[model samples]
Target: MALWGGRFEKGVDAFTQEFGASLEDDKAMAQQDIRGSIAHATMLAKQGIISQEDCDAIVSGLKDISEQIADGTFEYDVNDEDIHMAVEKTLTNNIGKPGARLHTGRSRNDQVATDIRLYAKDLTRELLEGNVELRRTFIDVAEKNFGVVMPGYTHLQHAQPVLFSHHMLAYFWMFTRDYVRLTAAYEAADANPLGSAALAGTTYPLDRAYTTELLGFDHAIPNSMDAVSDRDYLLDLEYACAVSMMHLSRLCEEIVLWSSTEFGFITLSDSYSTGSSIMPQKKNPDFAELTRGKTGRVYGDLMALLTTMKSLPLAYNKDLQECKEGPADAAKTLLDCMAIASGMLSTMTVNADTMLDQAHKGFTAATDVADYLAKKGMPFREAHEVVGKLVLYCEKHNKGLEDLTADEFRSASPLFEDDIAQDLDPEGIARARTTYGGTGHDAVRAQLKEAKAALAADEAALPKAPESK
Candidate 1:
């Protein structure tokens, strides 16, 4: 029978029951639901709402159910609707009246809100840890390729020369921002909502603070209606996932481009690469491409939930039941993508020689030449024009600025001197950018030190995993 079948004359239609059931998706939160119930049961006993013996029976029954779930021995029935109903039904059958007393002062409204918050908290911490690991991988790659020069791009056109370590640290900073957003999501979910039964304060003398402390929540939610109705924390988590996925997708796209024949800047590890079934010469960056493609799916998950919550009325409703799967799938997708990207980066072979080769092409030293003329006496705008004409002359003559003789440079700008040749070397050009946060050796070394310290601080600040009451 359905848990709410007291006044009904007949059973629900099978199709309706199956359609309304959430066990298939929500069972992922079964452990969280059990933990929430344990805390509530303990609180109920402390408040004299239930006898200590009954609380003991309920706690023992829930612990047994938790083991069954972990061991894959828990039987799920579609007729039970959701994980909460399934676990409660099984508990009632096993422990008799005490199990029935478990729901005395709470409703599924607040109960499910509590469960989802707990689940979000746990997943957010996991993502934070993964972000830190991925950042560490970035640091490793940066330190490994410390002084390698590469072409920095503006609109896919070579704009300047930069160290590869500088490029890697750029991503390190992006992920550091992602870590902050994920931490915010965790804080948003750290409130307890167990005492707000069915969208209103319950008649029972419930001590919400006891449950809050038992569950390791920072505080009990102050408003009853808001407690059961709020899903902003879940939104926060999914939003963090979406943004982080976008960042990963950008990195993956670069990996794909770099591994291609035209770029020839990187070669992915064989374990992370795939071979064509028909083409004997084909080695593909399939994992990077897949991670890039999965970015859209994570974005869609965020949008689907945002649209579902856009026009809903306050308090719990059936629509909220549709919210769990989106964030759950998004979190898992992002976590897997982070792991894959980290592995690909840690194992991939960087072609520093090839990068340096290409870094010298495309007149990547033009900016330095322009700056040379400006420093000598030319106004910056006039220096830019001179370099533009020089670039055109070099293209027409099929030569690079480095290929130009001092006399040839003097033909374009009288400011040119014999020292201008040194300015055209890609390594010198890259190393000359010594401003803080620049691609120069000192700047990147400073940034790397800061990144390592920031990562260590985050690891130290991450909260320990919450234990069951």
Candidate 2:
């Protein structure tokens, strides 16, 4: 007979068992389920709800089962319905009556809820580590290309020259925010819901605080109804994943463009590149394209959980069973994407000369020219118009602003001087914007220093190793 089958006159049909069982999907949460069970058993024994002998037997049995699951030797049954039952059944068979006492003060509702929170805590830590490692890569790449000038774009047109380090630091800040979000998600999952048995508080005198400490939860859920039904932490996790994926997609998009033959700003390493099957000349940014494409699936994961929880009545519903898959998949997918992205970035080669050469074309110096005139007592708008006309003249003459002679500049405005030639240099143009947070050499250096410090602090904060079992 099934664990919950005593009330039924007959066993469920095989098709119904297969259709309703979550063992396949919930398999990943088996360790979490076992962890929660051990905590619950310890609490039950502490409160005298069960014998100490029984609690010890249950804990020992659970640890053995945990080892079996970890070693890939545990068998799963469709009749078990979910990981909770699969694990409990295995424990009961391994330790007999004592293992049967393990679920005395809990329900599948609270059990699954606790399991999900534990899983979320583990996932959040992983994502934070991945975020930190990827940010470290960004910092390394930025330092490697420090003060290298590249054209900053607006609407895909060259707007100005900026230090390549500044470009890389922009993403560093973006992912820093993602780190904060994932941390918040971790905080959200830190509460223990183990004693919120079935939706109402358990009557078994279970010590919730004992379980909280044993399981390393920050707090016990204050409300039983909220405990079993709440999945906001998972949502927070998925939202973090979605936003992080979006940022990765943006970076991947730039990588694809920068590696293109037309742009030639960077070259992806062969390890991260895939050649066209038919064209021997083609070295494709397939990894980058894959990262961009996988972003939508992460978004879909977020939306899937949101749609599942939107209208379900509290405290627990069968619909909630569908919740685990999205976050599990999202976490795995995001972790893989981050690792691949870090590899792609660390191995890629930046074409500094090509980037600087492109930076010099398309009137990139026009803004600096206007700034030059404005600084010389001309109203900025008037200076902008003068520079615009000069750009037109240079274009018609098939020359860049750098190629224009000082005589040509003198004709446009008396404000133009010998120093105007210095402003026309792309490197000089990039160096001129020394405002705080601007793309000037010193500003980029300051930013990189701050980034390195941030990376150091983040690395210091990471767990030194996996938590000791």
Candidate 3:
């Protein structure tokens, strides 16, 4: 019989049962549900709602079911409707009337809310650790290539010369912000909702604070209705995952571009690449492409949840069931993407020589030339026009900016000296940028130090994992 079937004469339709079931999705929260049940049952016993023997039996029965679930020996009945019902039915069968008494002062509304919060807290920690590990990998790669030069792009065209380390550190900061967002989501899920009791305060003398402490929540949620109905915490998590996946997608797009023959900036390791069955020379970045593709799925997850919550008059509704799968899917997808991307980045080879060779081909130093003239008292606009004319001359003559002689440079600008040759070299141009956040060697070193400190701070802020045996 259904938990709410006592007042009803007719059973739910078979089609409705199949259509409304969330067992497959909510099954992932089985262990968390058991944890919440144990805490709730103990609280009930303390309040004298159930006997001590009943509390002990409920706890013992839940443990036995948890072990069976862990070992894949527990049988899940679809007729029970969802994980909550399945577990409760199993508990009742195992321990008789005491298992039934476990639901004395609560409702599935608050119960599932508590279970998901606990699950989110645990998963957020895992993602935080994964993010920290990914940042460390990026820093490791940057440290090894600090002085290496590359062309920085604006609008897909090379605009300036920058240290390779500086470029990599840009991604490091993007991911660090992702970690912050995840931590915020964790904070959102930290409150306990176990004693909310179906959108109202229960008449029983239940100690919500004690149950909160038992379950490791920061505190009990103050409003029962909001506690049962508010899934904004899950939204925060999905939004965090969506943004994190977008960042990863951007990085993956760059990885795909870099590995192409036209770019040749980096080559992914064979282990991370795939080969075409027909094309003999194909070394496809399938993993990076998949990461890029999966980004849309994460965005979809976020949108699905947003749409699900838009029209619901809440306090607790079946529509909230639709909210559960999205954040879970988003979190899982992002975690997998992060792990794969870190592997791709750590194992990929940087083709420094190829990057350096191409760095100057697109007039990457034209801005530096303009900056040089501007420093020599020419107005920046005037200097920019002067450099543009020089570039036009070089292009018309089928020559490069570097192919021009000192006299040619003087013809373009009277301030040009033989030192212009030194400035024209891509490496020298990159190193000449000594501003605090510039792509110069010194600037990149300072950035590295700041990045390492930021990384350490994030690592320090992560919640310690629950101790395992």
Top model number, lDDT: 1
For residues 1-469, could you state the per-residue lDDT of candidate 2 as single tens digits? 6788889999988998888889888888888888888888888888998999998999899999899999999988757888888888888888899988888989999999998999899988999999999999998999989879999999999999999989988999999999989989988998999889899886788888888888888899999999999999999999999999999999999999999999999999999999887999999999999999999999999999999999999888999989999999899889999999999999999999999999999999898899889999999999999999999998899999999888899999987987788888889888978888999988888888888888888768764322313
Error of 1 at 122 (Å): 0.9
Task: At residue 61, give the lDDT of candidate 3.
Answer: 97
Structural similarity to truth (TM-score) of each candidate? 0.99, 0.98, 0.98
Off by over 4 Å in 1: none
lDDT of each: 0.93, 0.90, 0.90
* Model 3 lDDT per residue over 1-469, tens place: 5887999898889888889889999988999999999999989988898999999999999999999999999999878788999999999998899988988889999999998999889888889999999999999999987778888898988888888898889999999999989999999999999889999879999999989888888889999999999888889999999999999999999999999999999999999999989999999999999999999999999899889889888589999988778888899999999999999989999999988988888888898889889999999999999999999999999988999999999999899998887778999999888899888888888989999999999999899754211
Over 4 Å off, model 2: 463-469
What root-mean-square deviation over C-alphas does model 3 reach? Answer: 1.4
lDDT pick, better of 1 and 2? 1
Please give the RMSD to the true structure for each candidate, in Å.
Answer: 0.7, 1.4, 1.4
lDDT of 1 by residue, 255-355 (tens): 99999999999999999999988999999999999999999999999999999999989888899999899989999999999999999999999999999
At residue 195, give the lDDT of candidate 2: 88
